[model samples]
Target: MHIGKAIRLERIFDRNTKRAIIVPMDHGVSVGPIDGIVNMKEAVGKVVEGGANAVVEHKGLVRCGHRAEGKDIGLIVHLSASTSLSPFPNAKCLVASVEDAIRLGADAVSIHVNLGDETERRMLHDMGKVASDAANWGMPLLAMVYARGPKVKSEFDPETVAHCARVGTELGADVVKVPYTGDKASFEHVCDSCCIPVVIAGGPKLDSTEAFLRMVHDSLEAGGAGLSVGRNVFQHENPTRLVQSLNMIVHEDASVAEALAHLNG
Candidate 1:
């Protein structure tokens, strides 16, 4: 591994735990400014105060979330985008470059690839190109891979999730994020098959906080590196407390009960 890549990854993944609690705030490009993230600096501060390892955002919004005084948090510049209003929303296109992330002082860069989409080939090509550029620049790359298309019955299907993870690894991502496959056993298989660190995506907001915490705990127990969740963490009633509870599970190895207790306390 390049020393630069390793050093940058430390910003995103805890050095002691080799895991991460990443909050993706890049949704502004995909779905417009939603709750919790409209004030980028405040949202970033809350999660950072809760000990989140990193926050992902698009290049332009970097200025909005930049902190002048506070505990530092890693910045991951998202390189691909497709708005929800687009006719082919699943088709993610490269909107930024590895060089752009470097210029923005990002610790890492990320791209999204939706397998089984009509523009899967183009996304894959973009990913491949970005991976090469990132490697050349020694910038850590996080691939957000998912199976979302007509043929896919359930995106949560373990097999499909594993395939998405594997694709990320084969394409040279240092870390890969995918939807959790519902249970520890199934998700364990997904993690086992990928050589690179695998993290779980938060997906849609769950009905309850305990349910969300339980999912995080289960994925960690399954050998997942940790989570790159968005809405669940940022949109929670208490974003700071929520991420602190998550930190306990991801870094302190707390059980669901213990983490939930921390959340409530």
Candidate 2:
């Protein structure tokens, strides 16, 4: 690993572990107040206390209050934008620059690119440029890759997810955030191909805790580094305990029940 990449990784992980838990709070840009994100600062505090290594957010969130919100956790500045109302919502554009993130003392940077979309090539082009900038500045890049297009899988098949991860790795991402393919047995292909550290994203808040924990455990069981869940953690009734339980699963390798015991917020 490059000295710079190693230094940036330290900012995002606990000194003793390779696995990490990061909460993404960049929702304000797309879905305003869907759920569990009513208070960004408060939500981040709960997760931080529970031992998340870092939090990924848009520039506005960081500018508004992430510093005081996440003083103890790493901050990854997200520079991409896409909205729910847009007909071509998958076409994300770069709204912020690496220089801006560096000035804000970001530990890393993240961007989202939907592979196979009509505008896929354009998005990848932007990602390449952003990745180059991050490399030149010695900052780590986290790529959120999702396969979406005319032939993309409806629920994200293992193969498609693996392909997405591979694309991110080939494009210079230090870490690739992807969606889980239901189970450890199924998603292992993604981890195996990317080689780069993988983190699963929480797509939407689940209806049950069992479903949530199962997904987290399955990801790690397969070979993932950790999770970048936001709504699932912040929106839970007991944010503190929910996050703590996630920490137990991700960091301590605890079973679902053992982890759940610590989650009665």
Which candidate wins on lDDT?
A: 1
Q: Which tens-of-lDDT digit does each residue in 1-265 have in candidate 1? A: 9999999999999999999999999999989999999999999999999999999999999999998898999999999999999899999999999999999999999999999998999999999999999999999999999999989999999999999999999999999999999999999999999889999998988889999888888998899999999999899999999999999999999898999998999
Clashing pairs in 1: none
Reference-based TM-score of each model: 0.99, 0.95
As a TM-score, model 1 comes out at 0.99
Give the CA lDDT, 0 to 100, for residue 229 in model 1.
Answer: 92
- Provide the RMSD of all predictions against the true structure, rounded to 1 decimal: 0.6, 1.6
**Distance from true location, Cα of 138 in model 2, Å:** 1.1
Clashes of each: 0, 0
- Off-target runs (Cα >4 Å) in candidate 1 are none
Candidate 2's TM-score: 0.95
